[model samples]
Target chain A: MLSIRDLVTSYGNIEALRGISLDAAEGEVTCLLGPNGAGKTTTLFTIAGILTAKSGAVVLNGEDMTRLRAAEVVSRGIALVPENRLVFPRMDVEDNLRAGAYSRRASAAEIAADVADMYRRFPRLEERKDQLAGTLSGGEQQMLAIARGLMARPRILLMDEPSIGLAPMIVAEIFDIIRELNREGVTILLVEQNARMALDVAHKFYLIEGGRITFSGSPGEIEQDEVIQRAYLGSRQG
Target chain B: MIDFIQNTVDGVMFGSSYALLAIGFTIVFGVMRRLNLAFGASIMLGAYMGTWLHVHYQVHVLVVAVTTVACTVLVGIYVERLCFHAVRRDAALASMVSSFVIWMQLEEAAIHLLPERTYAFPGLFAAGSYEAGPFLFRTEQTAMLLLAAVMVGALHLLLHRTRFGLALRATSENPLAAAYMGIHRTWTVLCAFVLMSLAGGVAGFAILATDQQITPFFGLWATFKGLIAMMLGGMGSLPGAILGGLLLGVVEAHALWYLGAEYRDLSAFLLLFAMLVSRPGGLLGQRILSREELAFRRV
Candidate 1:
């Protein structure tokens, strides 16, 4: 379980996340749906400790992780699949996956086994194991990014905009992967602009607007809300 | 023909030291994407420490070499902490300017410690020349060449076959993503500085030991030569650095022989200018991809 309480993060004078709080329960997918510039990515970054918070706390289970750096955050079992699927462009797919497990103190044999598991999970990666990650197709790169995050063996995975630029079919496939990951008992905190797809897999969803959580509800409750219908579903007939 | 071949041979032997120096610069540049102008000054200070030890305490050549490398690493850490670590990452110009100021400070510090225009640097090997098949090789230059090769081989292994090297390369490729992978950016950059400083110290020793002398101008000379070599070979490529150094050395040697010493530097710069016009990427440097091209590749 992860609890974020009144987290405030800023960039100079502009506050990107102004006292926003949310939670992702254990073994569940919690989706944050927001428009562009709605502090979606900023919230994920602040939770991953890539951006330091101005105030409040990020408690994973119970321990305070508010002041930890990104490296420490990963070591504490929170791995972020950053927006844009920012895989190491020049490195081969295998090395990129190897880099994913860098924070763990696992032995070579153990790490190799985990890498093998990734290869089995995503066969396309194994096929292009020796190819530079940048050369992979957009869909393949997204898979590699997910596999890389999974390589960290985190207690919770935070994925930001994994389907942002992918094809429609690939977006569906990515959501399927997300559902499978959750089914396998990995907790997930996902940020998405695709409310429809995210709502299908997410156990609970929160709608964020202008750096604040405007709505939070079950998938059924969300479907009946007029604001969700007009703003997210693009339907005025709600 | 014999004269040309002889100059080339001499150039190559001397160029090994240049290659070592270029490697130092390239490694730091590769990791940080910022220039540390104080690289040469740090090496100069380290060499000054060695020369002081030799002059006052009459230490062994081995002791001087160790002192030089250790001191260079210390000065390098100081520069990293003050100029690089203190500055904002996005303000690369600030880091460069800070390093430039540190270079002046380091050079002045070295001069204050020695207060001499020139001092003798202890040679690693006895003064002698070997004649083989009508070619002459100085003992120190030969040693430099051999050591440079060994160092390059060792460094290649360290970069390719080690976990630390992987982390370093990842950091160089993408600092933010590397952080997501839990690679400590500051620690990795510090390690890179220390690694390059070790190489720079050895390079400074080799060059000084071969010349058997040191002066305040050596810092400027080392910086320019290393910078030019790095640029010539391609900025960040390791092999490019080595190739550039050898090419610069050979060209300078021929110039010194044919056009006189005045044209030596001129010829080297001219080659760099021509290379820039013809192929701006250098002999082995890859053309950097534009953001659009990179995005296109992903799709």
Candidate 2:
């Protein structure tokens, strides 16, 4: 379980996350939905320790990790699959997976076993194990990014925009993967713009607007709200 | 024709030292994405440490060599802490200017220790030449070339076959993502500094021992040669560093033989200028990404 309490983070004078608080229970997909410039990505970054918070605390099951650096955050069992699927462009697929497990002290054999597991889950990666990650299709890159995060063997996986630019069919596939991961009991904190698909998989969802949480409910509750329907689902469902 | 071949042989032998120096620059630049202008000055100061020990205590050559490398690493750490680690990450220009300031400080420190224009450097081989067919090879230059090859090979293995290498390459490619993967950004940069300093110490020792002399100007000369060689081969590329150094050496050797000593440096600069004009990326530099790739990355 992860608890973020009144976290405030800023870039110079502009505050991206202004005292926003949220909770992600174990084995649940907690989704944060927001429009552009709504501080969704910033919240995830602060929790991952890539961006230092100006105040407040991030508690993982109890111990405070508010001041830990990014590496320390990963070692503490949080892995972030960053926005845009930022895989190492020049390294081969295998090497990229190896890099994902860098913070852990796993042996060569252990790591090889984990790599095999990843290849089994995503056979396309094994087929292109020797190819440069930069040349992979966008869908493949997204899969690699997810696999790379899983390589960390973290209890909490924070994925930012896993289906941003993929085709509709690919988006459905990604949502299926998310559901599969949640079923496997991997705690996920997802930031997404696709409210329909996100609601389909999210256990509990929160609506963030202008760096503040304005709504929180179950999928059924959100579907019945007129304002939520008009604001988020109107374009597609209409 | 024999003269040309002999000159090329000598050029390649001498170019080995430049290759070592350029490799140091490339490694540091590759990881940090910032230039350490004090690279040569730190090496010069380390070499000065060796010469001072030899001059004052009459120590063995092995001790002098070890002292040079150890001292260079120390000075290199100092530069990394003050000029790089202390500076903010986004302020790359500030770090460069800070390194330039440290270069001046190191130069003054070395001068204070020696207080002389030049001093004798202990040589590895006596005055002799080896005959291999028609070409003559100086004993010390051959030793220099062999040592350079060994060091480069060792460095290649270290980079391609280690966990540290994976972390380093990942950091170089994407610092933020590397962090997300749990790689320590500061520690990786610090280790790169140490690696570059070790190579630099060996290079300074090789060149000084071959020339059999040391001077204050060695700092400026080493920095310029290494920078030019790095730019020529391709910035942030290891193989490019080696090629650039060898090419610079061969060109300078021929120029010195044909057009007098004055044209040696002039010819080298001319070659650099032409290379920049024609291929700004250098011989093996990575080309700019395609527009489609760039657009995808942005999204």
Candidate 3:
């Protein structure tokens, strides 16, 4: 559903993503694995239009959407559940969901219905519908953030670090939710520092390091290569 | 005893207008983490429209106030567009002069229109004053107090109960994050500015109703009180602004009554200085920008 070619992004003097190119097929999970400062979030931000690209093209379903603003990109059916679960911290859970659905022109009744469906799926969110998002637990906040993104009604959902700093149980739960979401046919572009967990679920994976894509292949091929393993794991141990 | 009570009531009533102005001023500062100097002018513009409508159309006083408030909101939107929007990336104090320039322009226009003659606004409150010792309360003063309360309540309810209000509150805390949530950065800010300007306009009308005398400087007095209130209340906290205004008003009123009127402005300024020295974070303001928030935007 999404394709990128020669995408170069910079922040001031430093180059974040140096001439990177990748593609995600329709309705398939594409995971980007990287260590810190490896340009994982930068790629997502560039594609989501939060950061401007110095040069390159982001083609979504054959149409170039590289130049669109974040809000415009959302209207084109792209939503990013950003790093750090940057949920609208001060807004109520329900309002956060409403904010997610902001890009589309949904009627009040329709919005209510979508919100109800979201609440039904994520009951924790429904329970805390009126509470400030900032006060929610890290896991709950992450779930709320994802649920809020879903409210955007995007075709391709880009998630950055869905498992960072989360407990083992919560991380498992989040991955299960992602798997269920994918099974139900929502295309996902998940950026994970949790490489072992990412490799387990992702159909195809791309490894990024030092602002460049050094490898792109299936999980089996990536796990087989000693050099690829070193680049991904950073220590070929285990 | 009666004089003391009356003075306190007067102070509280006067404080209400100051509170509204302070709230408006602090709100923009809190959100963008920058002082919106043109804010005072935005209020004056609103006030001018309100009184102008009254002078021209012979509309009801309450209606005039509403019209004035609405006009200020438009001014707020315009100021946001022409002033704050462009200076976001420039020096922090780049827009400070924008307000002074607006103030001068407004002063010039008012002088031209009034034409070297002092003009008195029509007093809408039916006149009657209750007296006790050195303090007094006129029907107009009472009316001003009641109406100010109603305005504050309405403003508070709008902010707490509405979805747009929550978005606004969120914007005040973090504009960048608000944008990520699909809230239009410019629109949300414009909404806040409009609301603030409306408050300023209503304040002008309310003061005018009390026969407080409408010079070009009426706006300046209200703006000064607002700045003091912002310092007292901890910028951007709703309840805090009200308390600060009321406290400053009473302090000034007391000074006016006891220490003679010469001490009124000086007293208020000194009080604000004391408050600032004691609690630099402001009465309820936390996480405020220490240096200019706009300048901290090296990113």
Candidate 4:
């Protein structure tokens, strides 16, 4: 479980997230939906400790993790698949997976087993195990990024715009993967633009805009709500 | 023909040391995308520390060399912590300017400690030459060449065969993503400084052994030459650094032989200018991560 309370984050003179609060319950996918410049990415980054929050706290399983460094956050069983799937382009697919397990004190055999498990789950990665990650297709790179995050074996997986620029079929496959991951007990904090697809997988949803949580509800409630229908579904009549 | 062959061999032997220096210089640039201008000071530290150990403490030459390397690595860590790491997030330009200040302070320290314009460096190997067929080689020259080769080979292994190496390369390629994967950025940067300083220290030993002189000003000269070799080979390419140093030395040797000694320094610049014009990336340089790629983008 992850809890974010009154988080404020900024970049120089610009405030990206102002007094925003949200939560992702254990073994459930909590989706944050918003248009561009809504601080969705900023919230994930602050939770991951990549972007420092000026105020408030990030609590993971009741432990305060607000002051930890990015790597320290990873070590504490939280892994972030950043926006744009920033895999080390020069590194081989297998090596990138290994990097995800960097802070683990596991033996070489255990790490290799985890990598083998990843390969089994993502067969495409296994086919191009030795190939450079940068050479992969956009869909493949996104897969690699998710596989890499899973390599950490994190208790919580925070993904920012995983389906961005991906083809529809690939996006469907990514959502399927997300459902499978949640079934396996990996709590997810998902930031997405595709509200329809997100609502299908996410147990709970929060609509964010202008650096604040404008609405929060179950998928059923969100569907019936007129404000959500007008803003996200874009008027059924039109 | 024998004379030409002999001269070329000698040039390569000397060039091995230059290659070592360039390796030290370029690896830092590869990882951090910022020049540690105090690199030459690391070399100077090795020389001065080795001399001090030899003269005052009566340490064995081999022991002095090893200790000098250890000491320089510490100095390198100190430099990284104070000059580079402290202001790392501010701007790349900040680290660069801070390194210049560190280099000045290091140079000043060297001068204050030595005071003498030049001091003789005691040789580890005995003074003599060995004959192999028609070629005569100095014992020290062969040792320097062997040391450089071994060090470079070891460095190659470190970069490829170890987890630390993988983490370092990962961090260099993407610092933020590397952090997400649990690679400590500060530790990786510190590791790079340690490796580079070791290379510079060995290079300093080679310089002291081959030329048998140490001066505070030699730090500046060493930085200039190492940087030239790094550029000639390609900025962040390891193989390029080695090849660049060898090429520079060979060209200079030929220049001295044909055009006379006065044209020696001119030869290196000519080669660099030619490389810049023909291949701006250097011989082994790839445009994989350029200044644009490494630039800090404000979120």
Q: Which candidate is the best by lDDT?
A: 2
> Which predicted model would earn the best DockQ?
2
Q: What is the lDDT of candidate 4?
A: 0.87
lDDT for each residue of candidate 1 in A1-238, tens digit (9 for 90 to 100):
8999999999999998888989999999999998999999999999999899999899998999999999999999999998999999889999999999999978889989999999998988999999999999999999999999999999999999889899999999999999988999999999998888887999999888888999998889988999888889776595
Candidate 2 colliding pairs = none
Instruction: Sort the candidates on TM-score, descending order.
Output: 2, 1, 4, 3
lDDT of 3 by residue, A74-176 (tens): 8888988877888877668998888777777678788899999998889999999999998999999999889888988999999999998899999998998
lDDT comparison, 2 vs 3, better candidate: 2
- Let me know the TM-score candidate 1 reaches against the reference structure: 0.94
TM-score of each: 0.94, 0.95, 0.87, 0.93
Query: Which CAPRI category fits model 3?
Result: acceptable
Model 4 lDDT tens row, A86-166: 999988999899888887767789989999999999999999999999999999999999999988889999999999999
Estimate candidate 3's alpha-carbon lDDT, on a 0 to 1 scale.
0.80
Ranking by DockQ: 2, 1, 4, 3
Instruction: Find the 10 residues in a row with the least total lDDT in model 4 chain B.
Output: B290-299
Candidate 4, A119: how far from true, in Å? Answer: 0.8
Q: What DockQ number belongs to candidate 3?
A: 0.43
Off by over 4 Å in 4: A12-14, B1-5, B288-299
Model 4: per-residue lDDT, tens digit, B1-299? 99788878887888888898899988888788888898888678667877777767788878878877887898899889988889947499988888889888988887777777587777867778999999999888888889999999999899876789889888878887888888887788889999999998888887787777788877887788799899889887889999988888788878888789899889888888998988888888876455666684422
